[model samples]
Target: MERFSNITEALMNEAKIEIESFDIKDGEKIIAYFSEIPSISGFPYKIILVENSDGIVYARFRQWDTEYDFTRWDNGVYNLDRLRIITDEKILSQTESALLKEYLSQLEKIHLPENINKENVIILDSSLWKFGFILKNKNIDYTWKAATEDINVFVPLINLMREKYLDRI
Candidate 1:
């Protein structure tokens, strides 16, 4: 079985882009990051949220095509190629940005326990969800197979983003 960190590293390497690569002004920093590594039957994409010192927020969405060699999967490698930018560093309006920031704040308050057992879930074709957040004194990173209801807390944020930005794509 492949470790979740290894899978995340592979996906990040394949992306050729890192969250730190975004231009951050003196008072601006990345507040949160979310990514979905889809199963063989789903689409692959990532969403990043950044906020300035003034609480202004911006979002960027990147997607990739699955047109790569399937043989590499035997080695636990996912070939996510043909990069697509559904939303590129777009600044959200004040109202939407405030709402997004609120959602991020809510996520910060929720504590997802570590080492969740996956044996209970048996979905064969579920996506893997990853989330990262930078807080005042600590950073949080979590990943879980999308086969359990425990991860549903994130659904609202995902749905909001999808409805606001991804619906067109």
Candidate 2:
């Protein structure tokens, strides 16, 4: 079982990127959850809506695989290996792309905590918003908890992605 003491710390160490943290009250909260149930297949896939306490919202998506590894970026767009392409005639639809862009736009708006208690690991990429915590009625007390840190938030992220991918099939 892998443990991420904090999201920022795990991402910084695993992805080797630097991030600054602020007060959770000033950070973004999960507003809505979306999963496509018949498009893509296998692995973990998901999309999430996050909004700051000030009422600003955005979305981001993540996909994980156990095979093949590569990273490439053109202009501001990032294409990582073959995971970007689902099938010959079944690629990411315009709606999904637009939705992801909307989420990416808020990447710099939310505040991630400096430290959080975690107990598992999810293979993540260079994406900034890798993990999202689900809340109930905007209440932190209702957040989901997994036995291990990895099983907690990361597993749900993968499940969402899987649902979305299946939707395209």
Candidate 3:
């Protein structure tokens, strides 16, 4: 086995990740992707976005907190459709509705452009009541849940992206 020096190296080595190409008009930025994920068994899910500020890579996704008032896409544009609460799923009880409200509120905190297309929105909430898959270290947030991070999944993907896109190798 080629022992990697760190988590980033491992993911890039394992996944061999690659990024799809897209057009950008000079200063125009792309909204990589935002997804609300629910666990496989369906207890928890989370809102996450893979972001790249020109050359700098970062993830703006996080666990929703009451204090957060949806609004930050530092250097790139966000798909506005995500800002709204997803009502497609049927809420089983009032408590579920309340939980959905919380999730929607969190989604609102992410500032989005008015003309964002709905087709570009990718919301993958299973039960629609819970979300996970975000890890925070100081001010930087990564798109991995506590469980996922325990096994070291975040850095590898980061490394993979860097290797494929930035050619950090």
Q: Assess the local accuracy of residue 84 in candidate 1 as a C-alpha lDDT between 0 and 100.
A: 39
lDDT tens digits, residues 61-156, model 3? Answer: 222211121234333333232222211111123443343335434444654232222344455633222122222211222242222223232333
Per-prediction TM-score, please? 0.62, 0.26, 0.19
Cα lDDT over the full model 3: 0.28
lDDT of 2 by residue, 1-169 (tens): 4332323233223322111111234576554443322111233334555566655544444434312222332232322222332221122345654554454444334543433334264533322223434433232211222223323333443453444545432
Count of clashing pairs, candidate 2: 28
C-alpha root-mean-square deviation, candidate 2: 14.1
Q: With candidate 2 superimposed using the best TM-score fit, by how many Å does residue 167's alpha carbon deviate from the native?
A: 12
Stretches of candidate 2 exceeding 4 Å from the true structure = 1-25, 35-41, 66-169
By lDDT, rank the candidates, best first.
Answer: 1, 2, 3
TM-score: the better of candidates 1 and 2: 1
TM match of model 2 to true structure:
0.26
Worst 10 residues of 3 by lDDT: 83-92
Scored by lDDT, model 2 comes in at 0.36
Candidate 1 vs 3: which has more lDDT: 1
What lDDT does candidate 1 reach at residue 11?
Answer: 64
The top-ranked prediction according to lDDT is 1
Q: Judged by lDDT relative to the true structure, which candidate is superior, 2 or 3?
A: 2
